[model samples]
Target: MAAELYPSSLTTSIPNDPAVTPSSKKSIIQEPDQETEPAPTSTQPNANSSTETGSRWQASHPTLRERNALMFNNEHMADVHFMVGSPGETQRVPAHKYVLAVGSSVFGAMFYGDLAEEQCEIQIPDVEPAAFLTLLKYLYSDQIELEADTVLATLYAAKKYLVLALAKACVAFLETGLEAQNACVLLSQSRLFQEPELSQRCWEVIDAQAELALRSEGFSQIDPPTLETILRRETLNAREAVVFRAVVRWAEAECRRRGLPVSTANRRAVLGKALYLVRIPTMTLQEFADGAAQSDVLTLEETHDVFLWFTAAVKPALEFPAVPRTGLTPLRCHRFQSSAYRSNQWRYRGRCDSIQFAVDRRIFIAGLGLYGSSGGKAEYSVKIELKSQGTTLAQNRTKFLSDGSSSTFSVWFEHPVQVEQDIFYTASAVLDGSELSYFGQEGMTEVQCGKVTFQFQCSSDSTNGTGVQGGQIPELVFYG
Candidate 1:
């Protein structure tokens, strides 16, 4: 069944349809209070502006009292009704046409245009009541209070109503909170809403923390097109095996969504063109033999071709890409401006040189950038440890040879250590060498590396001269 669905000669290229542009539709609007002042002729005020003059001017306006009365208070004043939400869980909200018309041109056209409908109630089955209420609050008071759970829905309502300010605010809020756990989901939403800036930011997080992003529950909820976009990302910092597992998880979720049995054929069917984007040929022979081959998601011929490609002198053309991804390039968060080797300074006698650091977002700490021997060619034994509070998270014992150069040598851990956000972690390194080496001077308290900011402070564990202001521990190498 799976082989009949997917042929071996299937091309990798999948045609992407253009983004759907949301069209403005006419909606029902209730009548306003008899005592309510006439609606303003001008467009909505800039809700994001914080200027004192604008605030004072709006405060002194006579329509403020009318707006307060009409806000969500649908007593005898409402003439239009909106039935929002899905069946069996619908909510009817009463709104004044004048207020909505003043806030949105879409509403104005809907209620007052030449071909406007005189319907008393409108069916809005796609939007949630909470999102609609949020939009109303912004129109009435020029203030927006957004929650994490409803922000995306609110963004949808704002876009539907052509509320540009609220949409921009929602995008900014999402960008501020973006992490590996939610990047995939946000990437899906950003693409859906045509938010290129937010999409780019989400991609940054996904690429840097691809392993964590792919393992998140949100990854399974992403649409097939977003899944294809992620699978085709050559810079994703994850192994091909991890990508395969994530794809399988997404396929399972898709199966459950479609009410189909979670069988191998169903998974393969749901995957379709996305399966070809997984780059199974890039996985090691051991990975293929142990995982993909056993999963039974691929046809027998496809599995055979993979095995032959691994062993044959002349490999056959496979559907999946054979080249490995470029993966993430590590960025160095430098803590100091210059390096100096004073006669009395930079001498290490097994004392730990530690600095406390924290990041605004989650990242993987690959290793540290440290100064080597200042004297002629020499070898030094080094021990590095990372700790949060009093508990140790990661530690490594390694050795490095240094020539009489000013370059800082990279000393890495066995594996990258995942660090949480805004929590202080201490990175300490103790070197066993008699020769005096270069120490970092004029240390910085804050260093901005790409989108992630590294905040440094003096750690109590710094028994050596290393501090945020001076001593050792020149740089932190990490992937965001």
Candidate 2:
């Protein structure tokens, strides 16, 4: 019989040799087939490997900022072009298709989904040309110096393009930079963009300056839902009577806008759900009688309830729940130690405070405080250890110099320890450097350490078995 032929796409089959075994022949074919597969096959498995070696390699891999910086700075021959701006006036920005696709899901879907974008050119008409350029810089460099004037617009553009990291950056900027002048406007913008954290921050700001916020024109424009949320808060620095009066002003403005009657019932109707949130019980009888009770905004039944509660005639119709634990104090996230501390020998620094990390992060020194002109400049040898149950789990050591010009300094670590979730650990430092220059009063900072405690102070005498000298604590910062 004649041998059968094979198609070009398929490999040619070899005839069984008279001297060869089937099993050995199978092994030879398998090895060649692996080599024939695409180059991506090897890398794909490595990307998802569970081994520690693989994890370390993945963690150390270059970030988007690093890759983008190298590509744009060195001009790696961009493959895509964006024709951005108004009609008849536009700018062409060069970018790599791979970078854009990786940075944004929107870009990824547009480039490679069911409707693939063509290779030639693309236009972004909605995003401001300048802002879009800035977004590209952030997308590539992993950093942008955001300013108040353009941050909101930049955020809008980022959200439009589905660049979550950039959007988050913009939100963070707005959060820290929010001021009385812009709080109301930011509140409105936050609602429009569905940024709950920013909105909550605005509310917290309002609580601090409720009277001032009430006087702002945007106060009247606050949507009814937000109004209720603010009114329901117990910690509104202003008295209940003050907020009740503001409620009346807001309601009156709302009524006049609709050309409705300015009567109390009509005002109450306009106030809607917000009226119930006011804690009428907290108001003094004199204030309620002269203010809230007389206002057209509070209903007769609600006013009666207020009057009865103040007189102890009856319990309030509804109890006021505590101001849903107002905004977190700034100190909640970080500890501040203004005093100076000195150390002559290596020992655990101070009391260990329990640290509960909401997210797994690697913590590093935020600043190394050094005293005199000569104090901060010297390179200090230091090592930090994280101990769990008296065993050292992780450690990082390096030579660091404090910024000579400034009291606060930052240093790069040679080996930053990886922290995991729900692990109880304490941090200790070992130092062998020049005697640190300190203030008149020695300050002892605390850390979250394991269950080991030692009675030691700032003494260099380690000649005895029990004596340990205290060490200076470098203010630590955490990163994920």
Candidate 3:
């Protein structure tokens, strides 16, 4: 990867998809009256903009898309010359210094800082031309396509150039794209560039799929700091012994790179810090005796301490054991939403999505979103309950904000509610007052064979009448 000085123009045709995209679908909450915007981090462009864009795209008149294309084609306004890529392989992108400076703090400092007076060519030898072109297009047009193939390079360029918006977009792109294969590679890249969101998503993937990550070819490329963070995280889905085994595996692979025998003292020295990060006292007594004592990495005192603790000869300090994070089940926690708004909705404001767990979990329910229309000057109160078979397991009550919008309603539980396995847990909400007309997904939910979820509707008979099917569930967010 290298480059030299030259002047040329390039096109942004590469892929780098964001988590959300523009859609022509109408907002659940009506347009003019609804002040609630979608989550800012939503990859999808605003529904309002998307609908207008779609209409313009279908019309016989000039559209924003055409205007954007025209700007890309019209290179007469270009000022700066960006020579991107390696020496003989470089592509020159014609850009304005103003665009560059405005898009990036690093470019701003270079072009208008103390060194501003000394004119210099913009040569980016390390950046891929495809990526730089995408950045240029975003700077010039305020839009760029984020896809799987180009996001990494685009992210790298975004971070290096200090393009915060593009950096955020890239993080959103990588969040949905993370998997067993690219988790380690992306984690390393995220760490290097200091993208906290991307780093968090990568770590979550690693945590959720620890065994797969440990087996990944790129696992050995994980940096020490990232590895330490992973080891320290309590939410690692795998058992303690499995983590210890993974640490040993990573250390041995690292030793091989240094051309030393895995059992050598030098190798153990390299693994000392990582080995200490593993909770020795948490391992099975057999695991400590067979695994820890056998690995020459542990010092005699450390090994003795673990042995003493396990044998009750010494009571180790009460350490907060890292509880397994069962919060990674997005499939179980998601609200069933379809773009097509139809009759499959609750006539009443109160509804619930009941889920029977296969295992016990510390359940935290995020407030539900209300569907349907809003009214003028109305008050509403929600009484939420965790019930099983006509018995009240747990309950909470709260008043809706003055705006009467239920879309942003949320209450973080002081303590996560303990839910039991093989038991029916219903998150029932009962609404009072003429606040808002809440909707639900009536018969759209397809409960799989031997599945756990059921729709529970508590109230709505007043307005919707006998038409209410008690089976339709409303939208609710869950984190456990």
How high is each candidate's TM-score?
Answer: 0.76, 0.42, 0.50
Model 3, 350-415: lDDT tens per residue? 534243222232233433443322453455566666556667655667665535333434432222
Clashes of 2: 2
Between prediction 1 and prediction 3, the one with superior lDDT is 1
lDDT of each: 0.77, 0.51, 0.53
Model 3 ranges off by over 4 Å: 1-79, 86-91, 98-109, 112-114, 117-120, 180-192, 199-218, 256-263, 299-479
lDDT of 3: 0.53
Please state the error at residue 33 of candidate 3 in Å.
Answer: 20
**Tens digit of lDDT per residue, candidate 1, span 1-480?**
111111112121111111111112212222344334543222222223334224354555457645453344353456678887756868777778888888898899989988765998988876767777778766765556666666777778898889988888878777766767788888877887889999998887888778888998778877788899999998998889999999999999889877899999999999999999988988999999999998889999999999999999998889988989998889899988988886776788888899999999878898998898788677889999999998988889999888867788889876567787899999999999755898888899999999899999998889987898888779898977
Which segments of candidate 1 are over 4 A away from where they belong?
A: 1-70, 335-351, 356-366, 372-407, 411-427, 430-438, 441-457
Q: Scored by Cα lDDT, where does model 1 land?
A: 0.77
Tens-digit per-residue lDDT, 1-480, candidate 2 = 221111121122211211111012110011121223211111011222234124253345345343344343122356777776656757676677777787788888888778979875788655555557657665555545454555666677788778877778778767655544456656766776789989887765665555566666556655566677667666554667777777888787777766887886778789887876766666678987998777766557766766776677546765433233342221111223343444542222332212212223222222222222225466556555555556665556666664443253333232233333444445444544544443222233333422211111332222211111122332343322
C-alpha positional error of residue 128 in candidate 2 after TM-score superposition, expressed in Å: 6.5
Candidate 1 weakest ten by summed lDDT: 12-21
Cα RMSD of all models vs. native, in order, equals 10.0, 23.0, 16.5
Q: Looking at candidate 3, what is the lDDT of residue 325?
A: 35
CA shift of 293, model 1, Å: 2.3
Query: In angstroms, how far off is 425's CA in candidate 1?
Result: 6.9
TM value for model 1: 0.76
